[model samples]
Target: MTIRVTQPGLSTTVQDLGRPGYFHLGIPISGGMDRFALRAANLLVGNDEGAAVLEAVFMGPALEFTVDAIVAVTGAEMTPKVDDQLRETWTSFAVKAGQILSFEILKSGARAYIAIAGGIDVPMALGSRSTYSLGGLGGHEGRALVVDDELSLGQAGLGAKSGIHIAPKLRRSPGNPAELRMLPGLYWHRVTDVSGRNFFDDTWQVAPEADRIGYRFRGGRKLEFVDREQPFGAGSDPSNIVDGCYPYGSVQVPGGTEPIVLHRDAVSGGGYFMLGTVISADMDLIGQLQPHTATRFIEVTLEGAMKARRGRQNLLDELRASLD
Candidate 1:
C-alpha cells in the first residue's frame, strides 16, 4: 500500500521515537516533537509505539491513501477529514482506498501526528526512520514530504482496527501560561540572584523563532550576569562559555536576553552558558505551545523532577493498558 502527498503542509516529516546515541557526533535525536502524541497515534493504529508517522506542524498535509487502512490523528486539535467527511482526532478510523485525507485549520496546539496501520515504511538510518533534515538522513530521502511523494506502507499487524479511541484523560495538551519545570544547571551561578528570581517570576512569550531545533522566548526581563574576569578560552561575552556540551532541554539565554529551550533537533554542544534545563516531564508541553503563548519557568529539585518523570511514565503505562 502507498500514501501519496497531495498537499504538503507547512512542515510535514516522518518521525519515530528518534535516533538515539548519535548526539556526540552532532546528529540530534530528530523525531516527533510531541512524543506522547506520536506514541498515542501509533498505538491507536496498532503500530509499534515508536513506529514512524507523519508529523505536521502548524498546518497539516493532504494525503491520498491507495488502500484501506486504519488511521489515527493525535496531538494538535486540527480536525482530520476523510474525503470531506470529518473524523475525530485521537481516534482510529477507516479510510478506504483512493480516499483523500485532509485537515481543517488548527484550532489549538502546534503540531499533529497522523499514524497509519503498519506505519510509514521508510528506510531507517542509524536504526531510526526519523528524518534529521539538517544532516539529510533518514525518512523519505531525508526531508519533509513534497507533493507527489509516495510513501510505502508496512504490513499491518493483527491488532490494526478502526474505532479505537484514546480517552480524553489520556490526551495531553499544553496549558495556558504553560508551566515548564526547570532544574538549574552548572552555569546557574553565573546569573545574579535577582535575575534568577525574575526568571521564574516573569512570564515569557514564545517567540516566532520556535521550531524543531529550539524554542526562543521573549518578553522576559534580561538576565544580569555576575562580574567576572573572562576565562582564557571563553569569549568576552558573559553568556559565552569556553565551550560546553549542552544536554537535551537546556535553556540557554543568549546575551542573557531570550531564553531558548533546545528541543529534539538541537545541536549537541554550544558555547552559550545555560541557566538550566527544562525537566524531561515538561519538555513535551513545550512542543504544543503556539507562538506568542505565555509560559513560566518553575524551579524544581532533582527529587521533584524524578517524581514528575515517574508520573509521566505512569500515564504512558495507563495509555498502553487502555489501548490493549
Candidate 2:
C-alpha cells in the first residue's frame, strides 16, 4: 500500500520511539515529540508502540491512500477527515483506496500523530525509522515530506480494526500554565538563591522558537548569578561552562535570561550551563504546548522524579490493558 502526499502541511515527518545510543556520537534521538500521543496512535492501529508514524506540526497534511487501511490520529486536537467526512481524533477508522485524508484547523495543542495499520515502511537508519532532518538521516529521503512524496505501508496485521478509541480521560494535554517538574542539576549552584526561587515562582511563556530541538521561554525574570572569577577554559559569560555534555531535558539559560528545555532533536553537548532538567515525566507535556502558552517550573527531588516516572509507566500499562 502507498500514501501519496498531495499537500504537505507545515512540517510533516516520519518518526518512531527514536534511536538512542547514538547521541554520544552527535546523533540525537529524533522521534515523535509527544511520545505518549505517538504510542497511543500506533496501538490504536494495532502496530507496535514504536512504529513510525507521520508527525504533523501545527498543521496537518493531505494524504491519499492507495488501499484500505485502519488509521488513527492522536496528540493534537486537529480533527481528521476522510473525503470530507469528519473522523474523531484518537480513534481508529477506515479509509478505502483512493480516499483522501486531511485535517481541520488545529483547535489546540502543537503536534499530532497519524498512525496507519502496520506503520510507515521506511528503511531503518541506525536501527530507527525516525527522521533526523538536521543530519539528513532516516525517514523518506532523510527529510520532511513534500507534495508528490509517496510512502509505502507495511503489511497490516489482523489486530488492526476500525473503531478502536482511547478514552478521553486517558488522553493527555498541557495544563493551563503547565507545570513542568524539574530536578536541579550540577550547575544549580551557579544560580543565586533569589534567582533560583524566582525561576520556579515566575510564570514563563513559551517563545516562538519552540521546536523538536528545544523549547525557549520568555517573559520570565532574568536569572541572576553569583559573582565569580571565570574558569580558565570557560567563557567570560556566567552562563558559559567549559564545554560539557548536555543531558536530555536540560534547561539551559543563556545569559541567564531565557530558559531553553532541550528536547528530542537537541545537540548532545553545549557550553551553556543548565539550571536543571525538566523531569522525564513532564517532558511530554512540553511537546503539546503552543507558543505563548504559560508554564511554570516546579522543583522536584530525585525520589519524587522517580515516583513520577513510575506513575507514567503505570499509566501506559493501563492503556495497553484497556486496549486489550
Candidate 3:
C-alpha cells in the first residue's frame, strides 16, 4: 500500500522507539517525542508497539491513501478526519482507497501520533527508522515529510485489524500545571540551599525556546549558585561544570537563569550544570506541553523514580492485554 502526503502539515516525521547505543557518538535519540501516544497509535493499528509512525507537531498532514488501510491517531487532540468526516482519536478506523485523511484542528497538546497498519516503510539506520533531522539520518531522506511524498507500507503484523479503542482514563491528557517528578543530579550541590528549595517551590513557565531538543523554562527567579573556585576546564561561569554526559530529561540551568530540560534529541554532553533530571516515566508528558505551560519540578528519591517506572510499564502491559 502507498500513502501520499498532499499537505505536509507542520513538522511531520517518521519515528520508531529510537536508535540506542550511539549516544557516546553524539547521536541524539530522535524518535517520537511522545512515546506513550506512539505506542497507543501503533497498538490500535495492530502494529508492533515500536513500529515507525508519523509524528505531527502542532498540525497534522493531509494524506491520500492509495489503498484501503487501517489507521489510528493518538496523542494530542488534533481532530483527525477522513475526507472532512470527523474521526475520534485514541481509536482505530479504516480508510478506504482514494479517501483523504487530514486533521481539522489542534485542540490540545503539541504533538500527535498517526500509525497505519503495518508501518511507515523507511530504511533503518542504526537499527532504527527514527529521523534525526539535525544529523540528516533515517526516515524519508532523513527529514520531515514534504508535499507529494509517497510512503511505502510494510506488511501487516500478526494482529492487523481495526475498530480498536483505548479507554478514556488510559488516554494521556495535556493538562495545565504539569507536575514532573525529578531526581537531583550530580551538580545539584552547586545550587544554593535557597535556590534548590525554590526550584521545586515555584511553577516554571515553558519559554518560547521549547522544541524537540530541549525545553527552557522561565520561573522569574535567578537561581544562585554556591560560590566556589572554578575547576579546571569547567568554564568561569557559576553554572558551568566540566563537560559531562547529559542524560535524556536532564535539567540544566545556565548562568543561573532559566532551566532547560534536555529531551530526546538533545546533545549527549555539555558544560552546563545539571540540577536534576525529569524521571523517565514523565518524559512523555513533557512532549505534550506547549509554550507558556506551567510546570513544577518535584524532587523524588531514586527508589520512588524506579517505582514510577515499573508502574508505567505495568500500565503498558495492561493496555496490551486489553487489546487481546
Candidate 4:
C-alpha cells in the first residue's frame, strides 16, 4: 500500500533512530527530535520502536491513504484531522482507504511524529532510515515531504490496532521552561572561573535560529572566558578552541554569547569551545522547544547522567510492557 501527499506540511520527513557510528565521517545522526514520542507513536501503531515515521515540524502533512491503515500522532500537539474530522493525538486512529489525514494550526511544541501501522517503507542508509537533509543522505530521497510524494508501507505489526492511547503522564509535554540536564565538557575549564557559573545561573530562551542541527538560546548573561594565551591553532576569540570532535548534545558559545546545543543533525567537530553537553536522556526536551520558550540547564554528575539514562531505558521498557 502507499500514501500520497496532497499537502506537505513544513519540514515533514521520514526518520527512525538515525544512523549511528558515522559521526567520525562528518555524518550526523538525524533522527526524530523526540525519541520518546517517536517510540510511543510507533508502539501505539504496533510498529518497531525504530521504525521510520513522519517527523513533522510545527505543522503536519495532508496524506491520502491508498489503503485503510492504523496510525498514531505523537510529540507536538498539532491538531490532526482525518478528512476534516478532528482526531485525538497520542492515540491510534483508523483511516479508511480514501481518508485524508491533515494537521491544522500548532497548539504546542515544535515538532510531531506520525507513525503508520507498518513503518513508512523507505530504503535504509548506513543501517538506518533517518533523514539527514543537509547531506542529502537518508529518508525519502533525503528531503522533506513534498506534494505528490508517494511512500510505500511495510508489513504492519500483528499488534497494530486502533484506539490505543498513551497516558498523559507518559507523554512528553511541550511546556515552556523545560529543565534539561547537562555535564561539563572538555573545554569547560576555559570558561569555568569566568562565566561558566552564569551559564547555569540564568534562564535561557530558545532563539529563532534553532533547527535540527542545533538550538541557540538567548536571555543569558554574556559568557566570559578566562584570560589566557591563545593556543597555536585556536582562533583569536576566547570561545574558540583547537578544532575537535564534539560529543552529541555539546553546548558551545561563540563570542561568549548565545549558548548553542548541538543536536542530531549537528556537525561532528568544530573550533568553538564546548562548555558542557546535555545528558543523553534529556536531549528530547531540546527537540520540543519552540522559539522564545524558556529553558534551564541543571548540571549533573556523570553518575547522575548514567542513572538518568538507565531510568529512561527502564521507562521505555515499562511503556512497552504496558502497551503489550
All candidates: CA RMSD (Å): 0.6, 0.6, 1.1, 1.1
- Which candidate, 2 or 4, would have the higher lDDT against the true structure? 2
lDDT of 4 by residue, 1-324 (tens): 999999999789999988989999999888999999999999999998999999999888999999989999999999789999999999999999999999889988888999999899999899999999999989999899899999999999788888998888677664457888999977888885647778888999999989999999999999878889999999999999899998889999999889899998999998999988999999898899998998988999999999999988888888888797
lDDT of 1 by residue, 1-324 (tens): 999999999989999999999999999998999999999999999999999999999999999999999999999999999999999999999999999999999999999999999999999899999998888899899999999999999999999988999999988888888999999999999999999999999999999979999999999999999999979898889999999998889999999999999999999997999999999998888889999999999999999999999999999999999987
Task: For residue 16, give model 4's deviation from the true position in Å.
Answer: 0.2
Candidate 3 segments exceeding 4 Å error:
none
TM-score of every model versus the real structure: 0.99, 0.99, 0.98, 0.98
Global lDDT of each candidate? 0.95, 0.95, 0.91, 0.90
Q: Which pairs of residues have clashing backbones in candidate 3?
A: none
Q: Please, what are the lDDT tens digits per residue for candidate 2 over residues 1-324?
A: 899999999999999999999999999999989999999999999999999999999999999999999999999999999999999999999999999999999999999999999899999999999999989999999999999999999998899999998998888898998899999999999999999999999999999989989999999899998999988899989999999999889999999999999999989997999999999998888889999999999999999999999999999998999899
Instruction: Assess the local accuracy of residue 235 in candidate 3 as a C-alpha lDDT between 0 and 100.
Output: 96
Error of 2 at 167 (Å): 0.6
- Error at 258, model 1, angstroms: 0.3
lDDT of 1: 0.95
Question: Regarding lDDT, does 1 or 4 come out ahead?
Answer: 1
